[model samples]
Target: MNDLVVQTDGLTKRYGERLAVDSVSMTVRRGEVYGFLGPNGAGKTTTLRMMLGLIRPSAGTVSVLGRPAGRPDVITRVGALVEGPGFFPYLSGRDNLRTMARYRNLGDHAVDAALARVDLTDRAGDRFKAYSLGMKQRLGVASALLGDPELIVLDEPTNGLDPAGMADMRALVVSLARGGQTVLLSSHLLTEVQEICDRVGVINGGRLLREARVDELRGEATLRVRAAPEEAAIAVAMRVAGENSVRRTPLGLELDLSADAAPALVRDLVAAGVDVHEVSPTERSLEEVFFEMTAEAPTTKEKVA
Candidate 1:
């Protein structure tokens, strides 16, 4: 079996005068959650469409499951919920899944299993029009889960979800990966992506800026310390963390040293007659890093508005 679930080589898409997606290449590995992140109109949706063979790329190519994207055999092995769910409002959620299942030649058991996976079984009998935005999103996910595809592509899957609902969605994604399935997730929720995705591809201004592991993108963790007598604290931090390794921030002094060095640093601070107030390990948030990477790129129309 191919380790790469999805791969694109110089994928490009043009919309008349506008370049919707520039030359881009990305890969999604098997059994891992790959986060596709970007601001609105940053070509994320366009790239996804090309991958699904919903739209032909103006240039380049996309491969799914080691074959050309959109091949019948390859597409049947992949499930996707993009843009938004479109189902008959009059139909109950269960009926909606059943309809889709039948079209795919799947059985009723698959419908039930999908509904249960997304925790929509209790509301399966409710009409689609009566469901909340979050409920509708979950129902869409259930529809995608039908047939138990090897790879699932979800675009903003947690949109409109409450905190609890979001947590449940995160767990569901994690569970999917654990069960030997790959997920290609496009989300604006950087914090959520950081928590769940193994690696991420960040795009900006119709260009892919970076592709890396979550930790690699965030960089190394650092030690943050707050102590009385600011001058004394700075001296101690420099000596303990090595010269030029400490920087002053509004929060406190941040050192390049690891958390394991916290004990010795604290002891040194105390020995220097400094009153220690707080000491904790800190890591950069994905949101912070995202802004820095895209700061130089032009803002998309959605962001400008």
Candidate 2:
């Protein structure tokens, strides 16, 4: 079987005068949680729509499960919840699933299994209109989980969730991946994506900026140092980490050197008559990296997997 569950080649979408999704090529491997990250209006939803065949792309192609996306064969093997859940308000949560299952010619056991997977079994008898926002989201996920699809796509699954609800949703997604499901999740929640996704594709201004494992996207770890006699400390940092690798920040001088070099850096600082106040290691968080990428103009594409 192919390792890739989803692949898009130069996927692009335009809206008359506005470009919704620019040329984007990305891949999602089977059994990994792939995060589609971007800000509002950055085209995360647009790209996902194209992949699910919910909307036609202006240009480019989407292949799901090694076949053209949206075909009956492919769609049956993939499940998704985009924009939000829509169920009959008058129907109980259990009935809603039953109704949907009937449409798909699925059995009652499937509906029961779906509700259980989303932890909605406790509220399965409650009316859909009475469910909270988080419950509704989970019910939407339950619907997607029907029929045991191989790939699941969730768009902003924690959009309106409280902190606790968000944590629950994260745990659910992690559990899904552990159960051998490929998930392509789209969200603006940097911390959630960092905590759950194995790989991420960053999009901004309708274009894909970079796609790689979360760690790779964050780049390397750096040594942070604060010392008196700033000029001398900077000189020492430049010599140790190269002039181009040394930069100033509110935290102090950041050198593109690993934490293992802390002793060497401290020694150099002291020899240069610099009074080192602090020396620690820090790495840029996903939030910081996201801001930096979105702030810049679209650059050459990074490695995509």
Candidate 3:
């Protein structure tokens, strides 16, 4: 049996003369959170649509749980929230969940269980239209969980959430993964993705630039040093690490060197009579890496057919 719960091979989507998703391939292993990251209009939604069998790919294939995409059995094992949650505004949250459960041939007990999982049992009786945006998002998640699916695909799940709501969603995702469900999360929020995803695929201009573990894609560690005699400190850093290895930051000088190199660098700065106040190694955030990767990607003109 394949270890991967989701796999896409050369998935491509074209709208007339325009290529919306170009040869995108990705994999999501069982019991992991795989982030699909890209800016708005960078084919994230398009790719997701194809994965959920909402739209057919122009080329390539998608397999879910070892079965081809769009197969009824395979789809039943997957739950997804693409675009946003849609339900009858007049209906109560519980009624909406019940309605969805009926459509999926699920029992009323499934609705209750899903609501409890999302901590919405208390508010499940409220009208969908009266629920806050965060509440609605949670309802969407609850609906997805109604089938007790093995794989969950969420696109920008936290888009309308406030900070607290975002935090709650993150915690819920982590909890789900810990409970052994595989999750495919698509979003442009780098920090959120970095925090939750075990691995991430960076996409831009309808093309996937790279896919790597979160730690691997974080890039290199840099030394952040605050010292007096800024000019002297910079010179010393450049001499020790090389001219291209040093740069100025608002707090101090940042050296493009590993944490292991920090000791030698500090000694060199101190010996040079530079009053070093602090020296610490800092890991590059996902945002920095995202910008670096996307900026280096070949520019393309927007085309629509």
Q: Rank order by TM-score, top first? A: 1, 2, 3
Clash totals, every prediction = 0, 0, 0
1 versus 3: better TM-score goes to:
1
Give the best candidate by lDDT.
1
lDDT of 1 by residue, 158-231 (tens): 99899999999999999999999999999999999999999999998778899999999999999998899989
Which regions in candidate 1 have their CA more than 4 angstroms from the true location? 299-305
For model 2, give the 10-residue run with minimal summed lDDT. Answer: 296-305
Model 1: which residue pairs collide?
none
Model 2 alpha-carbon drift over 4 Å, by segment: 235-239, 267-274, 298-305
Candidate 2 per-residue C-alpha lDDT over 72-108 given as tens digits, one digit per residue, 9 for 90 to 100: 8898898899999999999999999999898788999
lDDT of 3 by residue, 1-305 (tens): 57999889999999887888999888889999999988777888888888888899999998889988878988888899888899999999999999999988999999999999888899999999999988898899888888789999998888778898799889989999999898899888889999999999998899989999998999778889999899999999999889998899898899888889888888898899999999999998999999999889864676321
Enumerate residue pairs that collide in model 3: none
lDDT of 3 at 231: 94
**TM-score list, all predictions:** 0.94, 0.90, 0.89
Considering lDDT, where higher is better, how would the candidates rank from best to worst?
Answer: 1, 2, 3
Q: Could you tell me the TM-score of candidate 1? A: 0.94
Range of the 10 consecutive residues with the lowest summed lDDT in candidate 3: 296-305
- Taken over the whole model, the C-alpha lDDT of each candidate is 0.92, 0.90, 0.89
Whose lDDT is higher: candidate 1's or candidate 3's?
A: 1
